[model samples]
Target: MTKLSLNRRHLLKAAAIGSVALASPAYLRRAHASGGEVNIWTYNNFVPESFKKQFEADTGIKVNVRLVDDQGKQFNLLAAEQPNPTVDIMTVAGHRFLQFIDSDLLAPLDTGRLKNWGNINPTFSESDWSTIKGNKWGAPILSGMEVLSYNTDYVSAEEARTWDTLFSEKYANQTAYIIQDMMSIIMLKMGYDGNMVAYLDKPEEAARIVEEAKQFLIKHKPLVRKYYDGGAEIQQMFVNQDIVLGHSWNGPAAALINDGFPLDMTIPKEGSYGFVYTYNIAKNAPNADNAYIFLDAILSSPEIGAAMTKASGYISTYKDASNHLTDLEKKSTSFTDEELASLQFFRAEANKMKYGLIDPAVEAIKAA
Candidate 1:
């Protein structure tokens, strides 16, 4: 795979620049002759600089991107903007779209307007997350998952194949994971059938499973060197040899492997969680025509999809995006058909209970 030089610092710097751009009123007012500007709210590095410049050059639609890392913060900002939102486009996770839909913050996507809509992989576009109640609400763009990542120099492929490796006595004090993710995966490991959402309506059962996971985490707390926060922190831990085994997002793990680190990640035998990130038009977008133009430009081109995958270390939902990837990049980021079949995607309708149960359980585990 071609090594991408971007690290967390570079991403943060980009986000800082985007934030400054969003804060400037004059920047938002600038218009082009061919098409008006499209204001987007998305994660840093989700839309690479190269793609943005090329899109602008091709369409004459100036792209104004505002970066927000936290999904909760993004939702609140969009909600606060009300019926007249400054953002024309925004990125949201598949499982989290229901709340936005419930609040009527998203506009129904008219797929007929997007000629390249067929380029999207059915795994995403056909899923319940995007096609809600017979209406298309978002365009699936990229996907990411939590996986067991380990340094190959110190950990064997055999050991990395299961979630149990994280708690092995031999690797104690050399393991790390983000708390909430670890807890959720633990619930999966405990025979929830990879369907935690099934318990959302059954509050008593949900609480029981969450409590069990919380206890398990508390027992294993001593094995973990740290409950890291972001992708960058886990990547740094691997680089410094502070962790031999970690629960990490596939994106960060892929970045380390591509950069020549002796690291590998796997979807453990017990299974893992996956979430799709999507692009959606904000309700009442001022430049709706420009928004559709921007979406078409990205969806139709495999080159843009490949660039997005490389820039973010996430899998592109564009079906042909892989054609542009290096063999090594494909191996690191793209999943095999069997692997894809085995994944349990997060459910959109269950966020309320999922977080209500998992969040407090995680806090209690941390306190323990």
Candidate 2:
């Protein structure tokens, strides 16, 4: 088979067989704070950790930040908890907001206390995935996009944008695939309509698109060194000359180049996938007022927000803060100015298929 065809098959097989595919975790009991605490569930290095410091300094609400294992699992866990939850707020993808809200795990929000709510960029305030129903249920702070990156030592930026070259038949098994659960984005990049994935994911039309992409990945599977789960590992692999070009988050891609790795990102002339995280209040939050205060306190300060932006490699939702970013970072902020104007956020009703798609893809690979 041609290398590209093999790569497609491998990708499908990996998605079908991979085990990182997470199912929504169920909650058996209500976990609540014992005192004047606002427990938060967020990623290890995102806003929660940085904001926690400022929040405690300002709100005196005694912030308790918990690192959840991962986004998919976190959502499943919250879904299980339902009426009673362990967290006051959980940082998850904005697209998944309604899934949680509809499950009744989130509480209605009051932005009145959030003086800086106006600072949020209009895109997020009404982005394709603002899932609070009629009222705002989640607060958006920072966002980034998936971009193509290449090791300058091996390839040029111009050449990195070509998925065809990256998954050539000659280098099929020598390639690497990302293990993050964003196969939809990959499929989208392969000439399929991701924007219409909501209607397409289950339709026979999508089958042609998916099968085409699947053939591409599986054909290249034998060439892949191994699938990577985190951006850090992916960066390391590139730095070590393990791969020439790959798909990765813009932050780490830029960081590698900023930190002096022979790396650079490809600003797809055609655009790329965009994504964001939202802060959702748990239904049974013990410190609702404090959470609101903390949300406002952190998001309002453009300086602090910009600092978080620099540290996290995401574009701040606050336009004022984004303007303050260095010209270089602004051009490279989770996106090229061109990409920000072009790429669409990866949005489809995040449902069981959203999570199920991962394992099924991995299973498909194993079967192959």
Candidate 3:
């Protein structure tokens, strides 16, 4: 597990200066005048320092950030702190929200409190993951997709458009990917629906499909150089010329491309899985009002969204965020309508069974 780190010193310093800022007679107050702190737990780089400073400056709300490196770890910590979570807001993936909801770790959002809520893209706001049962549990902020990426200097665009390129004899030992994600995409390439929830009623069919994908991966195991876990690991592999083709999250590959690397990513002919990351207020948060204000500030400006996208390489959820992006930034991050339509967004109902089948299968592939 990745070590979890907290920026307590920064939070302490912010708190120390809070009284001084409040004492200023000329201090400007924004739409929400509640002056308090909002403690956030999110992945590194997901929150830009510039945005954080700007948010504090504009609203006088102190932002205390804690960096969580692993999703499972974050969930565990939140569970352990139940009923009195230290985090006011945290980032949760669309597919993983169900577990948090079932555990009663999240608070239902009152969108009426967020004055800039209308700036959210309908594609995200209308998703089943965002609205559970009749309550809005989270506000979608960014999205990323699994993609086929390759070094353009070595792999042709035509070759990189299909998942088969990773297993081709021509690129043996030159490919890499996260094992579970690779298995999922291979299933899609094999003409399966890739919807695990639909197979829950028929566990036998799910088992059969998973076994097939497992066997296929074992057969092509020699073609792969490594099965990586994190984005940074894969990015470094590409930089060191250890991998010329691989499966990757669009964000890491986009960051490389934007940095003038001879790399590019595609959705592939078989389509791919995508997920939206959202900001949710914790249940029984001490500063729920401040959390609402923080969410509103994130949605209130296209420039904030743009800065977030540039920092993290994820597509922003703000409707007009792209207006502030450069052509290359847009090219690396934004998807066309056709491409968007081809993606299968991760579903909450499928979370358990999807991992149940895929996890053991991946371990078997690794062993073989």
- Please give the lDDT score for candidate 3: 0.80
lDDT of 1 by residue, 54-76 (tens): 66766678999997766877998
1 versus 2: better lDDT goes to: 1
Instruction: Give the true-structure RMSD of model 2.
Output: 10.2
Model 1, runs deviating above 4 Å: 1-36, 335-341
Stretches off by above 4 angstroms in model 3 are: 1-36, 58-61, 335-341
Provide the lowest-lDDT 10-residue window in model 1. Answer: 19-28
What TM-score quantifies how close candidate 3 is to the native fold?
Answer: 0.85
lDDT of 3 by residue, 1-368 (tens): 11112133432232233211111112224244566899999865577676677668777789999987556678999999988889999899888888899899999889999878888899899866688879988888989999888988889988977788889999999999888877778778888857577787888888899899999999999889998877777877887788888999987787777766788888887789998889999999989988887887777767667767776778999888888778998999966675676688777687678778888898899899
RMSD (Cα, Å) of model 1: 5.8
> For residue 56, what is the lDDT in candidate 2?
51
What lDDT tens digits, residue by residue, belong to model 2 across residues 181-280? 4355556666556544554346555555555655656666766666766655675666556677777777666645544456677656656677787787
CA lDDT scores, all candidates in order: 0.80, 0.62, 0.80
**Model 2 misplaced stretches (Cα beyond 4 Å):** 1-35, 48-51, 169-175, 179-182, 198-202, 269-271, 334-342, 350-359
Q: Each model's TM-score?
A: 0.85, 0.78, 0.85
